[model samples]
Target: MTTTVETIRKGRKFDQVLEGARQVFMADGFEGASVDDIARAANVSKATLYSYFPDKRFLFMEVATTECQRQSRDALDSIDMEAEPREVLLQTGQHFLRFITSKFGQQIFRICVAESDRFPELGQKFYSSGPAVFRAEMAAYFEQAEARGQLHIEDRILAVDQFGELCKADVWPRLMFGMTKVVTTAEIDRVVEGAVETFMARYGV
Candidate 1:
């Protein structure tokens, strides 16, 4: 595929707009953030912003998608595909926990949950970009492990759900409330160890 300069410039502008929209949404949320705010943050006129994004909802969704894709790519990139199943799972878990506890992740979760009722489509978009994507990717990894005789899981869906449940116990409470307590590296290591042990016990070679 030929890559044009105009296309590259447009891509850069889209990234800038998405980053600006993310800041606006995190600071002011859905209802509070206006097109003017996003345009000002992006150093573009309202007309230019509207030309890129039809409305605030669309802009917010785009920002959420961008964040989700970036995090997912980062997580996948950090893992060594040639590693053992257990090692890959542990590394992926640690990366996921770190990502979720970051500032941007917290803001994205807050915005999605807060505006879910008012903007049902946004909620769907958030789910599709975030958890759903993660689950699907994890399932693919599990499938590969099973093919290699590292795991005995027959059902990918069940394996994904089990992994999600394992992570949720540590992630949900902290995410749902301002429980000032931070998850330390030692604690994350413990969680990963326990989760992996249980998972392997259930489906190990």
Candidate 2:
């Protein structure tokens, strides 16, 4: 029987290993990261690390997926669900813009794309944990807003997707295309506020 990565048993040091992997992956690209370095960084033996993760790809995928999930969850937690549609959307758009334009997020995206041919699962994991998670959260919020008559949306999912695309208008493409290295606060604010305004104009009640 083949041992799947998911079947690996996570001991008490599971979180410790994940934290260590995240640090190393951030400092070094996926191809540059080594198991020995990961083990040393995690303060775990090679045996222990192997016990938890059979392969380096699996470890990297878990780290990326976990970080994406945490980012979305943290952003959702900070949002005021009861706030007016414009206020809530502004907050959400800001969070989305800042995170996607961050160094870690960019690295994860690049790594997933670069390694996709060899490891298609990495990209799938990233999408499910990042974009899909964000869409689901935003969809729920849109449903709530519609219920309160703050938004008139015939398709909540489509609106959620549109809002995401709107938030990515300028800054995200610039960063992705290597036209800009640093995402200024001003840029984030510009894109986020524009997205909110566009969304509210279309959907606000």
Candidate 3:
């Protein structure tokens, strides 16, 4: 049976294995990480680790996905979909900016980029578990806004992507390439406000 993140969260053994896998993968890249190290670190037998995750790659995928889900849930928890568009977008954008610049986020992102060529599927897994999920959620928010006549979006998917790009402007590109590590809260606010303004200008009915 495919292990869900919820199952891993609820099961102490599964959580142990996931924590061990995360630590090992962080210390040693995916290719260099060994199951023996994970089993030992987790204090579980090989059978226990294998029961939760069938292979190293699968374990990495599940761990990364679970982390992404946790971050997304935490960041987006305060967003009130029923709130004013400007407030909602501002809150969401700031949360996103903070998340991507966080230490854990940066580490996971670098790992995905560094190992992408060797483990192409890992990159795909990261995208599916992270950006794609966020985009879909944003699209749903746009659909709700349209229903309330707050926005007139002819193409919600495109709007979602466009808004995200706007929100990340001057932040993600610089941070991702290591041009600068400190994206001040003020800078994030400026970017998010500008994006919200532009988005509302185009979509607000």
lDDT of 1 by residue, 67-167 (tens): 78777888778788767888988887777777666655665667667767765666676677777887888888888888888888889888878865675
List where candidate 2 sits over 4 angstroms from the true fold. 1-12, 27-34
Please, what is the whole-model Cα lDDT of each candidate in the order they appear? 0.73, 0.85, 0.79
For candidate 1, the 10 contiguous residues with the lowest summed lDDT are 2-11
TM-score between model 3 and native: 0.74
Using TM-score as the measure, the top candidate is 2
At residue 187, candidate 3 shows an lDDT of: 92
**At residue 203, what lDDT does model 3 achieve?**
92
Worst 10 residues of 2 by lDDT: 1-10
| Winner on TM-score (2 vs 3) | 2
For residues 101-170, could you state the per-residue lDDT of candidate 3 as single tens digits?
7665676677677767666666787788777887888889889888898999888899988888898898
* Candidate 1: segments with Cα more than 4 A from true spot: 1-13, 23-38, 50-58
State every prediction's TM-score relative to the real structure.
0.75, 0.87, 0.74
Query: Which candidate would rank higher by lDDT, 2 or 3?
Result: 2
Q: Give candidate 3's error at residue 159 in angstroms.
A: 1.0
